[model samples]
Target: MDIDFLKSQLEDHDQSQLLWYWESLDKDSQEKLYNELKHLEFSNINGYFKQAMEDLKHASDKIDNLLQPLPTEVCGSVTGSSPEELKEYNRIGLEEVGNNRVAVLLLAGGQGTRLGVPYPKGMYNVGLPSKKTLYQLQAERLLKLERLAKQQTGKHCTIPWYIMTSEHTKQATDDYFKQHNYFGLEKENIILFEQGLLPCIGFDGKIILANKDKVALAPDGNGGLYRALRKWNILEDMEKRGVTNIHVYCVDNILVKMADPVFIGFCRTKKAECGAKAVEKTVPTEAVGVVCKVEGHYQVVEYSEITVETAELRRDNGQLTFNAGNICNHYFTLDFLKHVSQVEQENQLKHHVAKKKIPFVGDDQQIVKPTEPNGIKMEKFVFDVFHFAKNFAVWEVLREDEFAPLKNADTAAKDTPTTCREALLSLHHRYMLDAGSKFIHSDGSSLSDIPCAKKAKESGDCQKSENDDQFNKCEVSPLVSYAGEGLEDLLSGKKLVPPVQIVMGPSDITPSIIQNVTANGTTN
Candidate 1:
């Protein structure tokens, strides 16, 4: 059992009490706890705890002098590009997809603690008509994208989906996909690998025990992808599958386009080693990170790190100077990822500390969930590696169409379950408007204008406006049409009412209407 080795290591870190229950545990329990203790990475626990505690002191510091807007050439947007340019980008992106050169990486290690759920966020159903979870929706989108790519490029394609989970969420997430038969995706193509975990430490720099037999551990954030990839040989697997370009994104964005052709095409044409998909911040005080140059290096400057004056700065074109709001969507070259993953310890990304109301077992052998922050969990943000990119590009998308994050439960005012569902519905409603569909009341009154009538609002984001509530309740399944395409065949010249749901056959995505609301907003 290497008793001396274990004792010396724990004693060196002053964490010897971690094995307080070792003698009392049964053989199987002792074996489990021993494995956990062996992989705790406690050699540098003291260093990590000290660094975490010291980081809080400068957490609010601002670097306004170093902050500058992303260069025009490095930034591409739907508003800036002409229709021909966008189409060309989509073609290139689809060509890459059809050639089987693209892969998608989903960062979904978080438990739904903030959302008041005991499972992973990807398993959450935001009250959609189909009651599909985030993972299912994304899987369907990928299926559609593969079909679209094959149709466009005239070649068979498979866009591999790699999801990163954590110790707390891996089993649940793994079982979910298995139970649903991988949501129509190939079981092998959808790879599930776990990110690294770090031990949570209390104020005294001592490791907190979840119970007498276990340490309180937390996932080391999305930034741990680099290390995890190396550890799990994920990069080698991607290479084996012939994936050259990777699209990495968070799993919480309900409107996230899976392996978005526009984003992939933009980065491919620019030959960028790394790229970010961002939304223009309409409000200067919006609580989102800005994709800007920090000290001449491309990085996402946190909202808390920028001064009010810096955020409020406007350009000659009457746009916010620092407008590229990061959405945790990115593209990376496989070679660049490999290079980053192999860096030595000195050049590793810094781990940021998160203070939380950690749950732990007291000396009295009872579990206690603290109401106040009692411990720190060290993590690395995925964006922290931006500075390592030699050629970085930013693609701007409409906020309403591409970036409604799901974080909190329905109780929160923003980024809640209700809000996420509404965002997807509103975007689809606008898609129908563009496709020559009209929203009609039960009595044949107009609830919304037809396509040609909306001149000033070309993007169809007005459906998300505070005054309009009808458009927010409708839903268009991803299988029917991805990103509003192919809707013309179904919704063109059609009259639809509020709270309608447009879906297709589960096994086959042929255009079909599933349900429509009556006068009382419920289907008969």
Candidate 2:
């Protein structure tokens, strides 16, 4: 093998370690590298190698630029679609609800570190009626959706759940779900894959080696979903399974609409290579990426890119413009995914790094907090793939019903247990009101102020409100609570319904519990 020739050709001023990397290779490995280079004689070695080196440098530069405090444009507000556009989407959604070619790609690699839990994000119980975990809710939704598809179209819907986990939580996550029997879901349909990680670099840009042969690394952000799929050969697996349309989402959002056939159907019917779920911002400055045209091409502008002037832009009717806030729910066809995955492995997409407080050890046996930022945490946004799509579409959805993210600690108040509880109760309250129940005060009289369960629980029985003519001693159960569906069934009769308590995994409803103030009862 021509070792020196190969080394001379590859040595460069920027990468002084190339010589060390070559020296680390044994004779057999050197011969192999020489053979590989000889086989690529047809390729422009100098140009290709130089470009590869420059790409890494350029990516490093992008990170340096990112360090400068991001502008307000990094977040964006939501923009509601016209009523006519919404009507059109609704029509398309209903038509596509019956298609069996859609599947869900759930990103579940995150740990509940922010929540101070030692389990996967999917395992955190939100303290709902059933105590059902996030995974159960999503799994049950797939089950219900499949049944709905069969009932609506008379065709069997096989919606596969493609879950992505990380080295940190793979074994425990799988074991946790298996022990629970996947919450009555089909085990064969659940596919799990592990994402890749890159070594953390020090402030000097040198890779931080944790041990003699291993380096400390972290999961390449959720943006690496495509590469993880390719690395695990999941993209090819999906193709063989007859899945063309993939509805992908993160697992933290409790109210996410999963494997939404309507979204898939709309993408398919419209022939879109990629599509995203978005919501109109409550104001013009909410923190989220906005979908809009960049340099005459469609792209998502991170909030930091939007200035106050850009956010304040309004239409003729004085409504704030630029209102498409990405909810992280996306749809991509197999062909398009294939393209993106290929680019991902080839390092084609632009890379951005973040500097964080990575813990380390000092000579004095104390943990060191380096004053200067060290190491780059690489992340690939799912939106980054949009730039490669031949055609992309954005669909606006109702944020109030579907965008509560379960991130942060309890005190964060964004997606904490308390916040999720409130959101769920709000949904239930609307359902109850739709069923003709009136709100009552503590004194057993109807109240003008809408009663929140947090406050209502302190008062008295929710069913014993004033002006109870609409309900007459009928027993109404949530059949499906915010925790999950198919819980307790509602029983209707002539009398107003009484307050109800729900349980799970038990067939026996103790006589002591329902013995008082109840009416007719029903079971699922």
For model 1, the run of ten residues with the poorest summed lDDT: 462-471
Model 2: per-residue lDDT, tens digit, 234-333?
Answer: 9888888887788889998877767765566556555788888878765766778777656544567766666666776776767556777778899898
RMSD after CA superposition, every candidate? 4.1, 8.6
Pick the lDDT winner: 1
| Per-model TM values vs. the true structure | 0.92, 0.73
Flag regions of model 2 displaced more than 4 Å: 1-99, 211-213, 344-346, 361-372, 435-449, 452-524
lDDT of 2: 0.60
Candidate 1 colliding pairs, count: 0
